[model samples]
Target chain A: MAIEIVQCGALITAALLMIIGLVALVYLDNVLKKIIGAAFIGDGVNLLIIALGYRVNGIPYIFLQNMDVNSFLGQASYPLPFALVLTSIVIGASTLAVMLALAVVLYKRNGTLSATALLNDKKLGEENNE
Target chain B: MDGTIFIPLMVVIPIICAVLVNLLHEHSGVTKIFGYIGAICLPIVPILAVYGNHFFGGYQPLANGGLTVALPEAANAIISGSFLELFHPAITYAFGPGQQVILFVLGLVAMCAVFISIAETKKTSGVYLYMLFMLSAALMAFVLTDDIFNLYVFFEIAALVQVGLILVSRVRGNYETGLKYMLLGEVGGSFMLLGIALILGLTGNVNISDIVMMIHTGLVNPTNPVLLFAAGMLIYGWLYATGLPPFNAIKSEIYSKGLPSGSMLLQSFSVIACISIGLVIIRIFGYLPTAQMAMLAVSVIAMILGICMAMVQDDYKRIIAYLAVGELGYIGVGLGLATPLSITAGLFQAVNELVVTSFLFIGFGLVLYKTRTSKISKLGGLVEYMPVAALLTVLAGFAMAGVPPFNVFQSKYLLCQAAIAAGIPELAVIMIILSIVTFLAFLKMAYAIFLRPKPDELEVSSASVPKTTMAVMIVFLIICLIIGLFPGLVVDKLGVLALTAFAL
Candidate 1:
């Protein structure tokens, strides 16, 4: 029961991270801050995935010499989600880099990091002539 | 040799092309040759390759003797006694006849887009070509891969490549549009990952086939709250990916900001995204009526909003972009219906959309290329200047509006049929009425852009349309005609997917 509680706590933290990040993303007016929020969302998902693989008082996923294979299989923390999180991190970082780079360029062009100033529908609608 | 070799090559060739082109960007001559070769290969590889599943790194199921390490007898026994034995241990890409057809059409549109890209430009930028190839590779991966995780990897790649494609265009406000899309993508994409994670947590697998099998065989309870949440998240991601509702405006904005060629390819990616992600959703959640209802509801709204919003647009590009998205609702309706016939019809609509929408984008693109602007009110009497292009553009519009003897007509007819077969006759009426509205709306734009008297301030350029562009447009028209006259050519192949989906 204690182990499950700890696991649930971690899951809750992950969910909170995601919620906060999403709130920052939608409600925050700053473009750079929104990017940060986006990063947080990725971080939250990574945490959730890692949390899913967490085992209470579990053995390593690898097998050792002369180990009991059945016990090893039953007790080992999952390795799959870890591998997934690794890839997701790389993808998330690259995507962040692109978004950040785009933000920098938008700032240079429009001279503002305010999302409303740049990305609002009114601004977009007025841009058809060019 | 297993016929699966072509499957991986389908993805690899594009990446390879991207790298080569990026390297040779400084040399336009070399880049041009590489670009042509790469574009031609996109369609040809699909044609030459046989269909089958390719297990990456040769990691098939342990039950199939795919293990490299000798496992203990006890571990093997445990795996053998449960659903684990049948689960794929590696990333899998399944290339069925349906995928083949769709991929082929995608490759064709991509090929034409590239052909036009190379020919239309004074000198091709390797960076632009690089973005194009990467976008194709990502979209192809999305279609070919059976692993949802693999799909995620390429999903990010697709999103980034799409932004790069928009940025490659010198269109005003492109950077703003690209950044905005990325910002929105962050929300949509992160949630999508969370959804995939939830499914992974529940099923202990990332391979879609394994997850599906586990759920179907009662290894993982499908109705679990976590699983339902995952479905909801996945559906949210689908809406974002395909630009169905709240995202529709952004998606059409994306189309309007790209070069005509780039927009042509961009719309294909969205259509492919709609098909790929929507199929995954259906496969996992189709049994749930709520899931199907959600899909149907969004699709109907997208159809209505897409056309109505388009009718009010003054910019020709925006109009076509909205129309493209509006037409997307048909595919959504077809897939949302979740019946075998509806699924096939949906798939068919997707294929037709790839062709027809690309045709319209390219046709309208000619006007944009000749004139510096895409505003409908700024131009008129184009038929007097380029007779062939004007007539072809009008025909493309007809195809979009579902006029007879065009590919969209055939697909729309199938969609209506599928909707009725699913016991929702009202859905059929909606589709028919929308089809007519689509026609009228397109005719309005056609008249404004092609037939209206020339404005005094309209600077009509006398430059001849590129012969290559003409050839591509003619070929596209022929394809639409062929499909319209013989819908069986597509529906028969697409039906395989619907049947196979039911088998799942």
Candidate 2:
């Protein structure tokens, strides 16, 4: 029962991470903070995907020479979602790197990391473009 | 010697060429040859390859044979006849008539974009060409892949390549725009992934065909709230990808920021993404009238917002940008209608818009090339400088506005019929009014640029338009005319795909 609660808790944490990340991305004034917020969203997604593949007291998803097939099938927990999450993590990290690189460039050009200062313009008004 | 080998070649050739071109950036002559070689192959491979499925890693689906052959005997005995036996373990790419035509059009546009970009510059940057090729490859994957997760990977690739294309443009404030787009895109991308995860968690398979099969077989409940939520999330990503509604303003900004060459490719990407992702949505959620209605409602909103926004813009680039974004709604309308005829019309519109919008971008590109300004207030009387180009530009504008004897006309006529047939005549009326508004907006920009007297202060470049640009425009116009004259040549083939996918 306790383990089941922990498993469910992981899902709740994943949802909370996503919500907090989105709020930071939208409400934060600093551009760097917004990027960090984006990163948090990615981390949240990765966690959610991981939660899907989690198995309580399950064996590794590998076949052993002496193992019983039925037991393996019942106890091996899903490995597909883990493989998926791994790829997502790599893609997420690379994309975050690119975003950070762009943030650095924008800061150098405008000398400010504030989203308002960096993206403000006549064409890019707060109403829509921003 | 399998003919389907060309299917993978279609994507592989460009990727290999991207690397080659990137490495050979210092060698102008060598890069140009590689660039042309890769561009020519884009359309050719799709045409030559026979329609079939390619299973990556030779992992054929075990669904037909049951788990009896694939899984261990004990495991097979355990799940015996359950849905677990029907899961597809392989990555599949199915190429058919619809894919062939769509990829062919995308390749044509990409080829032209590459040709013009290389010709317009005295010394073309290999890095720019590499980005172009990579973007095309990603889009081709999106169009061809049967797995939704594969779609997400290529979606990210196309998005990143688009940012690289914009940053290379050196336009004022491009970096800022690029950063803004990326931030928003991260949100969209994450949600899309979450949706895919939900589908995986529910269905235990990422292959679209397998999921559809499970739902049809009554193995998975189609009315699950989680599935509905997933559909909603996927549609949000589709909106971002295709530049519909809330994303339209930024999507148009992306166009305005890109040079005409890159914008041409970018718009084509949105059109193709609309067809590919929209097809996935309908295939998965077609049973839900609410999902269909949602697509219809959002499309109507996009149409009104796009033209309204275009009408207020003085910069010709932004005007065309918004117009391009707005026209995407028509495609959504066709997809949203979820009927055989409507899907065909929607797809036909996608093909037509791909050609006409690129034509306009390249046409107006000449004005920018010659006058160094895209603002209508400062620009006037371009017809005198390049009569042939201006004439072609005007015709392209007419084509975009659904004028008769043009490609968009046939598609729009069908769309109206679809709206009426689907018991939504009000949508037909709205579309007709929006068509008129689209024409007027284009007319405003056209009259100002080509017919109005040249501005006293505007300095036009004495340099003539490039032959390559003119040649590419003439080719696109020919294609538009061909399709406009005999819509059957394309529509008949596309109808098969619509019938198969929209049969639900």
Candidate 3:
């Protein structure tokens, strides 16, 4: 079986997105940016799954009425990646919901979304106790 | 035919109940009924499934029979066992004697406590939904899974639901604690994902059996950096999830943030997550001597550090929280030892800890309700007034200390014996010494709160005994006694199954 160049490109793109997401979470102080980074990584995964099904000049995975069975069998895109993307999408949505829920809870408690404010509060509380 | 629909229903039933109860939240009476039905149904489903699957063998293909649940492929790579290796990932669910039975029994006891708790609190619906979700997910992951990736997915789902349940208590400071939990959980999730990616990259198969077959052929070389990195990532993930040393601070903070009722839920999740994660690592990397060493070091750190921290705590819940940390260490030690005896002992210890700790945490909940405080030094002489509560509380504390005729003692004995058999006499001695310290500390607590002289102004009313709360405590206590008496009933069966799971 011949490897598709487009599929290779998509995998590399997904890998880069994941690396970027990791860096953003680690290096950025802003919480919203961190969330966006996570979203990008999730999108990248969805893209990779789609790409895995790609075949050069392959016809869409649809049946035409009156088409011969032999011709119909040879043209369909892979079905497994389509199913995987659906599963990944559900997992990704749930993760987003949780991350958002936590972020909202944090905002309600502390009144600021910045990491700096959290650090400041901790330092202040410690000094007062001392 | 290990029944498929029943296993999936294990998760589905509670979820449906959660939705129904949440809709009827305004009608407390309706919610209570829903709660009772849920509690009773949750454990029966899995227990009945085991019986039906064993007897009927109406085995439909799981994931179209792609995933085969066999022991050698699931646990030890080299050990051969009879089981089908599924072509695609399907539920290759099987049962034996050892950890699976222990977990089922633990799940039963936890459900009993949860039911009693329904009567303990009012206007609290949908909490049981999360509880059932956590239980079913943990058990499904523990028993049915044949792929490492599926196990990781269940771990993530359980962690997410568990953190949500912890915050649902809506107690003060809970948000912050939940945040910490989410952060740690995210890191753990990332590490586990990376580990899965590495394993797949090396072997091109996510199904555990194929990975093992590849490893056996030297196609997946042990010295591969990706494999080593995957191993490290897996261990670190286990540490965070289990709340081992250095991670204890977060566990303490999270447990303290929730009300005791909520803490009861958190504690059980902690036990399940730790054991499941440990089991996964042991399954994947059991052949590696270095991985065994790392597990041993973690077990030691958890036991020693947890007890040391527990000793100085004035807050009663914090003390128990620390002790829970240490108790998990005993489980880890059993897995680390990896001998048949030790692994069985560790799994048995896990069951003991589940029952005893639920009782202890719930028993403490009654105190929190009465005194409106969890501070040990602030209250005394509870035995004079709340005699029943005091009795249950004492029983739970003693059980935790590995007292005879209590659930934990049997497992504790086996852990020591197993450690000795493994030529680690020092671990056995350390465990013995830790048990002594644990007993002394609990004794101090018992004396200060229940046995010591009563202070004036502390009122004990018959009203203090919530009928529902009493029901919960009694139910939990009965489970502890029942399991303590028939150790082999659960251990022999669960151990055999767990050993078989590993062998496949």
Candidate 4:
């Protein structure tokens, strides 16, 4: 009973974190904060994946020469999701790095990080060209 | 060559060339040679290879290897042994006529785009060539991979390369657009990952074929709310990736800001991603009526909204971008119809859209190259100076608007027929109206830029049009005419893919 409650708690927490991150991503204006929001979303997803693989007092998914296949399969937690999350985290980090690089470039060119200011500048430039 | 050898080579050669080009960044001559070689070889290799199952890491399906379980008495008290054994999953890539057709179009476009980029630019940077190769390679992988996780990885790579393509173009407003696209892509990708996790939890496999089998065997419940949520999440990623409605705003901006060659590759990504991911969704969740309905509704919205938005754009690039997004809706409708013929038409539209859009981008690119502007309002009477370009542009434009005797028209006709046969005549009506609207929109731009008297501010004498550019445009126009005349040459292969998708 206790183990089931703990599993549910972890799942709920992961969902809440994801919701918060999404809110920040959609509502926030600052480029840097939006990037942070992206990271939060990645972390939230990572946590969710990890929670999916969790088992009560589960053993690590490893094999020993002497261990029987049945015992290993019964006791070990699922390892596929863990592997997937690890790759997901790496991809997320690379994406975050690229986003930050673009942000730096935007700041250098426009002298601002706010999306609204950038849009205004574009509008003004278009009008000038016309 | 063996299936394993050539299948991976189709993806790897471009990547290797990208690295080689980047290393030879200072040697323009050498990079040009390497670029040409890579571009020419990408399509040829795929065409030469025989289609079959190519398993990454050499693991076969569970049916090939029988299962066995062994349990020790000591550990039995703590846990049950029934769940311990699982099939070792391998990344399975099924190469068939469908992948071959898509890869062929991608390769041809990439080749032409790279050749055009090399000829047009004064100083060809290796990094630029690198991004082009990376983008094409990622797209090739996107269409070829059968593993869900592998698809996600390639999808991210394609996204980054898209940003790189924009950043390297040195266009104004590209940086902000790239950032916005990246942020949204990140959110969409995370949701897709969450969805994949749910599917994995339920099915215990990432191989798409295995998951399909599991679902078919009733191991995974199709009607589960959790599965429905997964479907929704995957659909969100699909919309963002393919530039469907709501995501179309930033997507059009990305296209407009890119170098025309880059835009060619970018639109290819959108088409291939739509086919690949859209098929995946239909494969996994076609059992649900809501899923199909959702796709149909979104597609109609994209068609209506894209044409309307396109009609109002002053920039030629933005106009093409929105129209391109609108064309994606036709493909979506075909997929959403879920009939074998409709799906075949959808895949056929994907191929046509790839070639036709690239042709249009290159045609308009000639204008940008000569005039140094994409704004339709600032230019006039280009036909007098560049008659060949104006002619080809009109042809490509007609193709896009689904005029008869063009590539898009046949596929759009099939789509209409499929929709009506599927008992949804309204979809056909809406599609016809949108195509007409698109035709008018393109006609207006055509008149404004190509036929009107030359404005004083626009200098026609200084415009230097390259022979190579004209040659590439003619080649694309010829290809379009061939396919438009004989779509059966490609549609037969696509029919097999459609049947396979429906069977699953």
Candidate 5:
């Protein structure tokens, strides 16, 4: 009973973290803050995936020469989600790097990181054209 | 050719071309030749290949030895003793008639887009060509792969490639637009991952076929709260990826800011991804009326919002972008219906959209090419300078509005029939009304840009469009007419897809 509570608690915490990150992403106007928000979302998702694969009193998913297949499968934690998390982490890092690079470029060109400021400048350019 | 050999080749060829293009980045002459070959071959190989299931990693479960596994108590109650496995949990690609038809359209448009990029740009950059190839490969894999995780990976790669396509164009506000798109895309993608994780936790599988089988056999309860949450998350990802309502504003901005050739590929990505992911969702959750209704409502709202938004835009590119996004709703309506005929019509609409939208982008691209402007009010009397381009643009416009003897007309007609047959006459009526509004919107654009007197501030340059760009538009025009006249050629094959989907 206690173990089930811990697992459920971890899952709930992960979901809460994701919601908070999403709030920052949508509500925050600063581009840098948005990027951090994206990273937080990634971390929250990774945690959720890891939590899903967790097994109480389970060993790492490794094979030994003498071990039987059934016993090993029953005693070991699931490895697929862990492998998936590794790939997702790499993808997240690369996306973050690209986002930050674009932010740097935006800052250089418009001299502001605020999305609203950028929109204002665009609107101003349109008005000038008209 | 063997199914396994050719299935992987469809994805591999373009990837290899991207690498080669990057290596020869400084040699424009060599890279251009490579791009043409790569583009032409991507479509042909898929058409010639036989259709069947192809397994990778040499992991055929039946051939290795079918393993009998005991089911959990709940699953045991629904089925007999043990489950017999036929395929291993390896990367599987399913090639059917539907995949072939869609891939062919994607390939053709990609080829034309690549050719136009080479012809229109001042200097062809190898990295740009590389991004184009990578984007094409990612889209093809998105359509062809049977593994859910593989789809997610391709989705991420396609998003990054979209950003690359935007950044390399060097437009004024492109960096900002690309940043916003990437940030939102990351959040959406994480939601999709969470959804996939939920499914994996429930089914212990990532292969889509296996999950569907398990769900169908009642191993995974469709009514479970966790599964419902997963479905909701996946639907969120679908809406984001396809640029439905809230995402439509930013997506249209991305399209307007991108180069015309880039927009051509961007629209293709949107069409193909919507069909691919939408089909996956329906395959898994079609039993739930709420899920189907949610799709229907979103698509209907997309149609209303997209056309309404297009009606108010002054920029020519932004207008077309909104229209392109609006057309996506028609495809959505087809998928949302979930009937055999409706799914087929939806798939056909997807094919017609890829060609028609690209034709419009290229036709309008010629305007931007000659006049160096996208604002409609500042431009006028283009037909006097470029009559051929003007004619092609009108034809593409008419096709977009579902005028007779154009490709979209057939699909739109079929969609109406399917909707009414499915007991949704209001949807058919709404579709007709919105299409007329779309036609009027195009007319407004046409009169302002082509028929009105040339503005004093606007300089009508005498520089003619390149022969190659015009040739590409003419080819697309011919394709539209051919498909419009005889929709059976594609629809028959699409029927096979619908039947297969029904069987599943």
Candidate 6:
């Protein structure tokens, strides 16, 4: 019952994180906040994945000497989610690195981090004649 | 031979090559030798792949498909004893009937572009590392898998590497362009992930073949919204990756900022990834009427927006960038038509566009070298100062305009047949109008930049055209000629496979 409760708590946490991310994406005026929302979504996804991988009362999946096959099959800790989480983390980190580098460049070029400001700059020369 | 091993190795080899090249890049002589070696060796696996398909029927080059080959008893025992959950336990390399041949040709040409870029750059930088790495990852992800999630992972990796390469060039204005690309591209990636998550939840599996089988087995709802969402995410991702209309802002910026040779590789990688994913999504999810409608909508937007935007661009590279985006739409529309002729025309155009762009961009790069500017207005009377460069540029320009005796012309003609056959003669008319617009734009640019009297600000370079530059141009030109003269050589090989795959 406690294990079930913990699983419920995880789901709730994941939902909360996701909702906050969506709201942030929808309402945030600042570009940096949107980025933070993006990160929040990534975090929420990771948490949800871990929650799905959760096995009640499941110990580490190490195969011990003389391990009983029946017991293992019945309640083996799920390792697939763990592996997936790790891969997703690596991918997320690389993406973050590239994003940060780009953000820095954008800031340098336009002197602002606001998307609207940047869009305006993109339209800089076109406004004169038309 | 083993799918489990070969699939990952395709991504790994180029990574290893990138590392080695980066280490040796400081040594000019060593870098040259290593680049040549890498270029020559890169195509062997693809060559072997073609032969492998013939010898071992239905064997995909990489082992991740649903079909599995049983491991030898001994090896199985060892793995079983070790309690190792092999990520890939037994090789289940499944290549859809004739995908191997089409993938092989695309892979060969992509590698060819990389070799040509390496030869042209003549400078030691991180660019080559990113170039080879991006190409390898793109092709590996493209050819080796029938899995949707794996495709997403590889696509993200390739996008990162290509963005890195675009930034590596110290050319003016690329930094801003690269950032815009990164922001917008990650949004696309996130959508793809969202789609994958929903699909996994709905289908209980991540493998595309498993999902396809499940659909056939009645275990999956063909009209599930989750499946529709997944298809939508992937198509959007491809659009952003390929630089189509809605996402054209970022792609145009990057192409306008990066060097021409680099842009050639970037363009090919983006287009191939788009077409591959676009085709796969159409194949796997075409059962859904909504999915087909959605794809048709994206194709229309991309086609209309691409050429219209191309008609208005002032910068030479931006014009090419818009056309590249537009051309991808044409390919997308062909894929959408889902006819044998259309699919073949799309694939044929893909290969031709890649080849034709190489010459035009290289010619423009050479012109940039001679004139030191990319703006059409600033470039004038190149005929007097650099006759050879101007002549080649004109030929490339004509090819882009779809003139006769060029590969693009043949491909475009087939695309027209495809449109008309699909009962979209209006689209055929639009295509012809766009071709005319492209011709007029190129003619204006050519006359303004190359044929007219020299602008005082345009400086002719004291140095002669590098042998390597000329060689790259000649090589691409010859490829265009070969494809143009005998379209069947490529079409005969790739057409049937594309038709079979897209036919469902």
User: Which candidate wins on DockQ?
Assistant: 1
- The CAPRI-style docking tier of model 4 reads acceptable
Q: List per-prediction Cα lDDT, in the order shown.
A: 0.88, 0.88, 0.70, 0.85, 0.86, 0.68
Q: Using TM-score as the measure, what is the rank order of every candidate, best first? A: 1, 2, 5, 4, 6, 3
Residue clash pairs of candidate 4: A70-B70, A73-B84
Where model 2 places Cα greater than 4 Å from the true spot, the runs are A121-130, B63-71, B76-86
Between candidates 2 and 3, the one scoring higher on DockQ is: 2
lDDT of 4 by residue, B127-228 (tens): 999999998899988888878888888898999999999888877766777787898899888888888888988998887876776786687888888888
Report the C-alpha lDDT of model 3 over B259-311, residue by residue, as the tens digit: 56567657776777677777777777878878878888888999998899889
Docking class of 3: incorrect
| Cα error of candidate 4 at position A64, Å | 2.9
Candidate 3, superposed: residue stretches over 4 Å from native: A1-29, A33-86, A116-130, B1-5, B51-86, B89-91, B127-141, B217-219, B453-462
Error of 3 at A125 (Å): 11
TM-score of each: 0.97, 0.97, 0.84, 0.94, 0.95, 0.86
- Docking verdict class for candidate 1: medium
- Tens digit of lDDT per residue, candidate 1, span B1-504? 766798999899989999999998999999999999999999988877787788888888876775787768887777775767788988988888888888898999888988999988999889999988999998889889899988888888899989998987878888888988988898888889989999999998988877778788788888899999999999999999999998999999999988878887789888988989998888877678899899999999999999999989899899989989998999999989998888998999899989888888889888977777788888887888878898998899888888998888888888888877788999889988988888898788888877889888888777789999999999999999999999888888789877766665
Q: lDDT of candidate 3 vs native? A: 0.70
Q: Which sequence of candidate numbers ranks them by lDDT, best first?
A: 2, 1, 5, 4, 3, 6
* Residue B444 shift from truth in candidate 5, angstroms: 2.0
Looking at candidate 2 chain B, the ten consecutive residues that score lowest on lDDT are B61-70
DockQ by candidate, in order: 0.76, 0.49, 0.19, 0.48, 0.48, 0.33
